[model samples]
Target: MAAWLGWQIESNWADPFVFAIYSLVKPLAGALILVFMYAVIAKDGLHSPLFPGVFVGNALFIYVPAVLAGISWTIIDDREHYGMLKYVYTAPVNVFAYLIGRGVAKAIVATVAVVIMLLLGTLALGVPVRLAGINWLFVAATLVLGSAMLSLFGILLGGVTMITARHNYGVGEAVAGGLYLLCGVVFPLDTLPAWLAATGRVIPISYWLEAFRRALLGHGTEAFASLSDGVLLAVIAGSTAVLAVLAVLGFRLAERRARAKGLLDMQTMY
Candidate 1:
């Protein structure tokens, strides 16, 4: 799985340098868009206090969709593009474990993307990141815990796509996009409608992002102050545990259905 993921990244471009550049450029562009949007709205250039919030939000936001699409698309890639589903299905190795490996690879990629965004925001865009004031221990804890939760969520999405939209990779993309909006990536959850804000409360990303910002920025925002740090961590950890179990169950069900319907190797008009 590690070798396959390495090949996946390397095969994307002709040169290793180009691939590295592409990875940095893509996330940088995403971070810049939100930063500049905030600048425009505030009419105060990039020096607003809100810069850190937007910066951290966009930087971390890249992981949510990237992880989901990475794991879910690998399913489409193997089953549809490479026509290797039959081989994969018949393998003695556990399929859930295979999916977890793919998710880990994607999580590593997302970590690099986050680093690139942080560098770009601080070095290029002049977004203030007070490195000296950051609580490195808490930040590290938030990142590790948050990544695990997001990866498990990705595995769950992969299982759902396998059962419902095996041939359509766009389903993965669409689900990620929806989560981006509903997860409060760019804006505060309060900005959303009452129902949407309520919905965001249940999603782990909301708590994860809030805890992330508090750890990195050294201050908690009002949006997430109702929950203590312990509570936030508990939610993230508890949700991840629950999602891991669901992902395993979901994969089993999806596998059974695919086999029963003869859809494991079936190619459809996607």
Candidate 2:
């Protein structure tokens, strides 16, 4: 199936040393900068409404570590890990605006990061980026949608983290850390293990990747491998859209309940 889908990995490991560093350093550094930004914000004022901004903004490069780090910082504090959740929910602003702002910021950043990474991959890493089958339009569209979906997942997790007794932050971190790899950011999904691939089907990011590859990288992306394939790009995109809407509703409902019960006033303890 990998061969059929034209899944070939071109290695540049032995390439010019400086180029390799340049290729990897930017994203790593960018990711670190994000972590630092969040850390400073968290330290400066954990109670500020800044977390939603920090949480959504750093997602630009899909650095789950940075994202989770911000998440951890946003929730955990000196006295209590879940400090800011209470105050942020009390603010009078339209919560969706905050959510949308974060999403837009992250999407723009991720798109720019994608451009920078591609340039680094080609110029610095010595990676061959075939322009064949690259559909700039659809790729752009899907990427926007994909980033939005990922942001929604972040929000959903953040909200759920607040109410749940289980400190699944560790598990959530592990899962987020593997998002890019599991979703085939640097590798092809076709190369995923049988079970992993099966699970990948349910993740909207995977379908977006498969479709994005087909639209941009080239044809035979395995996204439209089978017309009858249950996990079609259309289906994944639609499902994620629904999830995004539902997440917004869930946030509203949570806020209302938190206000009514005064849970919003109590300090959250991990």
Candidate 3:
């Protein structure tokens, strides 16, 4: 798809210094998704899957591989190419700390891209996005906690599958193309079949996206009226807490295993 879109990835463009990083939107979105997937799996386990978010995330992961991949590549290319992987791995900082910091940087970059895309849509393309400004507390809450959960999940995937996954490209592509169909990011959940919608709700992205849209699009007051503000707040807060703890635990475990086996020094491509 990136090739079809005429994206030419050059280490250096016609100009000498600047790198030609085109079609970055998709990858940035993928990073956010990587995080989202981690949260859903950890919190809901496999039973209550966050299909919608997973779908969207999986779809974005194609050429746009998650931001973590980009970060990993930077570390690999610039640092590891110089035989620095072993040095970094031996740092006093625990494995989870390193992973979380890297994940945070990647997720933030993705989010900035998301903001840029929104601005482009409104300013360049004349997309009319009305900011109802209702329940902004919830929207802000979603932006922070929701994104954190997503990032933590991404890190978890990094922890469990980051190693021994020779088919990162294939797996990422399958995820980006297939998962979004369920996420309701590009399409509404109601548009899907009843069974599918119900199933999609089991996924994480749908829950977060729907919750976000309602808060942002002015649909929350009507749809979520049944629940008290405290209840909704609790859900968001709980998701954050759960994801945070798991992210720490997951990264530590993965790092411990990887370091023990000397996998961190193993050759890995972005």
Candidate 4:
């Protein structure tokens, strides 16, 4: 699945040079946009103390679209494009496990995106990541827990896409945009309106971003300090557990309904 995904990402350009250039350009362009936005707002170019936090936030934000689009489109691709949904449904293999494998593949891609962002930010944007002070173990732990939560969230999104049979790309974009605003991807949650802040609280991405920034930046604000590593990990674990159950149930219900409605192989209008 991972190999297939890698091919899908780079298969458009037959030339290896062009493919490699685009593979770097796409994510690096995203990082540059965010960095430029920050510079414009701060009027400090790359010297803003907030640059590192914003860069890190924007870097990790790559996961939102990667996992969500990957899972949702994977479903859309198999069912609508390839017309293989029914065969997979009838097969002995677990469908959810297959989805997880695909999600892991996307996660790997997202990790590469992060590395690209870091390198671009440090070398080109002159954003200081302070690698010497970062706690590698804590970063690893936070990434594992956060990735689990995000992957489960992707599964939930996939299940919803299966149920609706709507444009999965639109659904994925909506969810990713909402998270970008409310999940503190490029700013602090406290700066948001009261209602927005409240909404951010329930989403695991908010906590994940906070914990991750703390680990990578080696400093914590009062807001982040309010929640210990133990508390953050607990919330992430609990959310993943709940999301897992919901995804399974949702996927099962969607499969049953599609079978009943004879929509498993239905052609997508869009």
Tens-place lDDT per residue, model 4, 151-222, is 777777877777676666588889999999988777777788989988988898877787777777776444
Query: lDDT by residue for model 3 over 131-210, one digit each (tens)?
Result: 66557787677667665665565565566553543654444335534446765554456678888867665555445655
- Candidates 2 and 3, the one with greater TM-score: 3
Q: Candidate 1, residues 1-270: lDDT per residue as tens digits?
A: 743663574346557677667767878777767776877887677777667776887788888877767777667777777788688778787776676676666666677889878777777777666789777887888888877777677777776676665336777678778777877777777888989988888888888888878877766556677888888888888888888898778777877887898878776657
Residue 134 error, candidate 3, Å:
5.4
Candidate 3 contains a number of clashing pairs equal to 24
Q: Model 3, residue 187: displacement in angstroms?
A: 1.2
Encode model 2's per-residue lDDT on 1-270: one tens digit a residue: 211111111113345565445445666575456445645755653233333222222323353333333333233331144355455556674544544443443343344555665554445433344566466776666666665566566666555544544454564566666675566544345677978766766676666555544554344344336743234556767877798788777766765665676654455444
- What are the runs in model 4 whose C-alpha is more than 4 Å off? 1-16, 220-222
Stretches off by above 4 angstroms in model 3 are 1-83, 123-128, 131-135, 169-179, 193-195, 220-233, 268-270
Q: Comparing 1 and 4 by TM-score, which wins? A: 1
- Model 2 scores what on Cα lDDT? 0.50
Ranking by TM-score: 1, 4, 3, 2
Q: Candidate 3: give its CA RMSD in angstroms.
A: 10.5
Q: Report the number of the highest-TM-score candidate.
A: 1
Give the Å shift of residue 77 in candidate 3.
6.9
Against the hidden reference, what TM-scores do the models get?
0.91, 0.60, 0.61, 0.90
TM-score of 3: 0.61
